[model samples]
Target: MTIVVAVDESSHASRVVEEANALANAFDDSLHVVYVLSRSDFVDMEETNVSETGDAMDLDRVREIAASVAEDAITDANATAESVGLVGDASSEVTRYADDIGARYIVVGGRKRSPVGKAVFGSVTQSILLNSRQPVVAIRKD
Candidate 1:
């Protein structure tokens, strides 16, 4: 089974990749990295495009941009893992992918958020931690 790392554009993504890489090496497992572009990202992108270009982006352009961003994040992770850039809900997609692949472990990055902040913002990390059936390793931002 693979060691799956759920990646994003967050600053702690590299740390998560490093930790997942180490785990994969230690466990003699393949490393699988994935970046999910949620619907919210599409909405944000459309808003930005409208504001900047005076028009909203088409679906194809939005998907292209999302894939590009995912590729950039995967490259920045700096690991030689097999990577996938997908479009879906972040936490659910990551967890579902890991389950579907029968991952040995799932790695994710965590930001230090106050209880109130977490309650209001609703963290993806927290969602994954709570929902995933597989072993999850959370790497906190330094």
Candidate 2:
């Protein structure tokens, strides 16, 4: 059976990878990593989107940063198993990938967030929990 992990190169993500690897080792299953680059991360040089809340980040730059983040997560995951696969998008992307690979479960890392941040950002964990058809295991960073 294949286990899919949603990684973002964060402490939480690392923890998830560790847990996933442990489970994989015990069950003799393969581990797959999915790193999501949000649509807001795709930006063109000529276009500029300014938010009323004054939070503006370059989509193109975010993609580059996300790629770096994915690389780091992949490296960390490799320490456990050399055979690792990467997919983009922690939300829908992860779900699609899991379906594509016929994964039995999805392991996701959830970080502690403030009430305000949670309200505004809408945690990916929550989204996956609500959306995924397969079982989703959310690993928290302690």
lDDT agreement of model 1 with the native: 0.82
Give TM-scores for every candidate, taking all chains together and pairing residue i with residue i. 0.80, 0.70
lDDT of each: 0.82, 0.70
- Any runs in candidate 2 off by more than 4 Å, and if so which? 44-68, 77-89, 114-117
Cα deviation of 61 in candidate 1 (Å)?
8.5
Reference-based TM-score, model 2: 0.70
How well is each residue in 34-108 modelled by candidate 1, as lDDT tens digits? 888888877888898899999978876665665565456556767678766667788998899899999989999
For candidate 2, the C-alpha RMSD (Å) to the true structure equals: 6.5
For all predictions, the C-alpha RMSD in Å is 3.1, 6.5
* Candidate 2 per-residue lDDT over residues 19-121, each given as its tens digit: 8888877788887766666554444321344434355665555655555665577576563442333334558777887788888888888878998998898
- Return the top candidate by TM-score: 1
> RMSD to the native, candidate 1?
3.1
